[model samples]
Target: MKRIYNTLFIVGFISLFMSSCNDWLDVRPSDEIKEEYLFETGNGYRTALNGIYRKLATFDLYGSNLSWGLIDGWGLVYNLDKAPDDGGGRAMKKIATFSFKHSELTPTTDAMWDAAWNIIANCNNLAQQVENEDTLLFYDRTHERDMIFAEAIALRAYMHFDLLRIYAPSLLMNPGERTFIPYVDKYPSYLSDRQTVSYCLQHIIDDLKKAQSILLSVDKSASFSMESRFIQSYNGESRFLGYRGYRMNYYAVTAELARVYLYAQKADEAYAEAKKVIDVVESKKWFAASTSSSGFNKGNMKMMEDIIFSLYSTDLTDWDQKINHLSDNPADEYNEHYLCLGDELVNEFFGSEKSSDWRLIYQLEGKYYDYYYRTLKYNKQKEGTTYSKVNDEMIPMIRMSEVYYIAAEAIYKTDPALAQKYLSSVKKGRGIKNVDYSQVTSEEEFINMIVSDARREFVGEGQTFFMYKRLKKNLLGMEGYSWKEVEAKEENMVLPLPDSESNI
Candidate 1:
């Protein structure tokens, strides 16, 4: 068994950077090498897990497209003022318009697909190693092996969930057999075929539940927060025990479960998971709501305290400067991906509390940028000194406010009053002196309010699109278009699968 495990780990590690699982299986390195050193110690096991996270934060993933670049364009988060053929210099126009099949979009579509699976492949490697790992190998920390194992499971499920959302149709309304994305699990997952929509949802839910059971206990003793998850340097074995916020800590796994359940349209399960996080957040004080305007500042624009789970990308500082662009000059490098908004859209979108909505007043204010509502959510280079390294290079994956949104959306139809209270919590946290849920009287209105808040809260974080996609909400007016709203359809909603996938 030991010899067999060693061979598998060695082969898997060799293909860690390969673009696809199929490529991963085919790698025939000129010289055989062993990664037995990595699994021999508790921290060695940790090294494998942390490597998965580093890959997740790359420019191809959350550090760029998944957060504020390509994904946001699909969410219609930016104003694509230039026409592609007009040769006006901005390529964001084509992406924002969602030219999925366009030749130029192929590299991105392919990269995203490859990047996701590559990271998933890493998860598979760490997962298999940790599951059969000897408890004694984890040294003095009790249940540490389970912690690593559970995070890998949750991360794998989280990746599959996104793949389903991005590559398939929104089955909440248009339930059909036509849409599917693979639910990859095993190492050398080359044979994992695309599954039905419902099939994928069940597996995602099951994986999260499995992770939840292990992490619930693992995280209680660990209780990782944004601050707790770090040290002066990540140089020691003890470093693995900290940084719960960076990993799929208990709350993060729960939050992710809530997100998955909601996507699965299992509102009751979603509500329970989401509400559980909201209830414990204040008591545990692991993660919290931003009670003041400090979070909206340029330095803390990703709102460090409110984050549930995030990626600490080493490349973040430099990466955001180009994408969260502030240049009035068109020729600025990577300016085509620049994200911005008009002043009127900001006010109209947030409703009556627009005056106190810190997102508008502080996060989108012009003091730091060349244009109105230009976001500093990702870019902090100009104000880097003010931002603490504790939260620097961090790209948010989930936040406290999203838990509330999930809870409210999950229960809105069954219990409107309580659902409104959930919305009011996020509103109050956002600097609204008077939280109001009066307008959310009807289900349609309540759903719209949630979508509206998504636009306001998830400006460049690349969340609003999934929210819009899940609910199939029309793109709320803006984007320099006064015409009727664009209806959500498979063509516009589903990101075209790369040829590797569609061809297969």
Candidate 2:
């Protein structure tokens, strides 16, 4: 039987105290109200927006699967061993090998599809309600209505873009090609046509543009003239109020614009958008690199300033434990079930630079267990707070370092000097020596340097595969295996649609 996907019509709002104690941004809807009542008030719209964020923090999305789990496994970065006869390791092996044909993947893909679409459905419902109602009627204290509406639009675009990355072909290989994932705006009627990559990207850009316009207007308003007003927390006294890096704010929208342009192969456009963000970061001094050797150490939330958009999750420890603790014996600390850094990547890519790079020296290590080098980026659990306290570790969705990388890649063709400057910005931030563009003899060498830096910078963040796919670069294998580039016609680059969509 095909499981019917339904929207959560009634969303209950949780108190700030309770919300902080549990999931980072989950809005537990305690009341069963009609959809009409839910959208009638400004608080209703806000609650609905919070619910969307909560859905994104699920195990199927950024909380686990998308970040350090399935996606990174697919990138072939880890050493994945086959499961024992107990049958628990089959799914892990399939994900590590990129074998999506396993029956286990069906549930994973299906959950992703359903969760993403359900969030989109809610965003559509909120958007329609905002259009139908008057801003003056609802409590306009915080410019709540417009802000919530804008967030909904931006998040809708964000989810759609991720879906495209996972399921559609790279635009480089199949420009103007159509018919993959649907660009769903309205609630699905079970008959939405599959959209082309070009069409979906255009729609996503349109939504982000709308959100940017709304936020700009809010920034210019007389009562709340400060730009921080858009990202202020519900609790006035909270330390995290002004630090709205957790929410999709203006800068995040701009960053996403740059990313989308890069994915669409619009180099010039991407360069411009990325430069705009770089200029803003410079003018506002909104970010700084981690100076401490243990800057990205586990249990640390000090790097929040460097992050542009991060999803809050109190259940990070739980998720980390589940992935790291695969053995039946609790005392076995050296179990091989954990994912290790690729041997070739460590030997070839970071050969000489590994010692100087703090990102490598501190972030990547094999000290957790013998012959098991694991990434501690996501291991942020405090010593005494396991299963009892809320850890503030966030899943970084976008960061300032990424913006610099984007700018470097986009402008390297037209302005090599300027591109090198942008690239060196990240290098300097990471305490590494600056790169001399004049020293780089060929464009291919420059590009390879950029990709290598990205590999080092974004380890365990699930960006390596997308970087490889977007550039059609060869997927690097472990020491014994030969590297092979993914062909344009390869079906594995993008996952197949779920059985529900196929059945429909």
lDDT of 1: 0.69
Q: What is the C-alpha RMSD of each candidate to the true structure, in Å?
A: 5.2, 5.4
Per-residue lDDT of candidate 1, residues 1-504 (tens digit): 111111232222223332221223343342222345557777567667766777777777787778877777677675544112221113345566667777776777677777787767767788888898778888646589888888888888988888888888777657577646677787755455667889988988888899999988887676455456543345465566766777788888899989888887788999999988887876776567667775444356666777888887656766555454435455553234445665456666777877778777766645224334566665554444455565567888998888899999888878888888888887877787676666556788887787777788887687887887788777653565342256787777887777666643
Compared to the true structure, candidate 1 yields what TM-score?
0.86
Best by lDDT: 1
Model 2 lDDT on a 0 to 1 scale = 0.65
Ten contiguous residues minimizing lDDT sum, candidate 1:
1-10
Question: What pairs collide in candidate 1?
Answer: 229-243
Candidate 1 local lDDT, residue 163: 80
* Per-model TM-score versus the true fold: 0.86, 0.85
Instruction: Write model 2 residue lDDT over 1-504, tens digit each, in one string.
Output: 113223543344342111211133333345444555566666666666677776677677887677766676666665555122122234545655566767876677677777777767778777767755677655564455676778788998998998888888777667466677777676534457778889999999999989877766554332221224223335642322244566677778888889888998998888888887787667666654555545344434324445677776767656665565445354655444555565455666665666677666655655333344566666655665321222245677887788888898888888888888888878777767745466587778898888888877777677877887788775664522344343434466787777657744
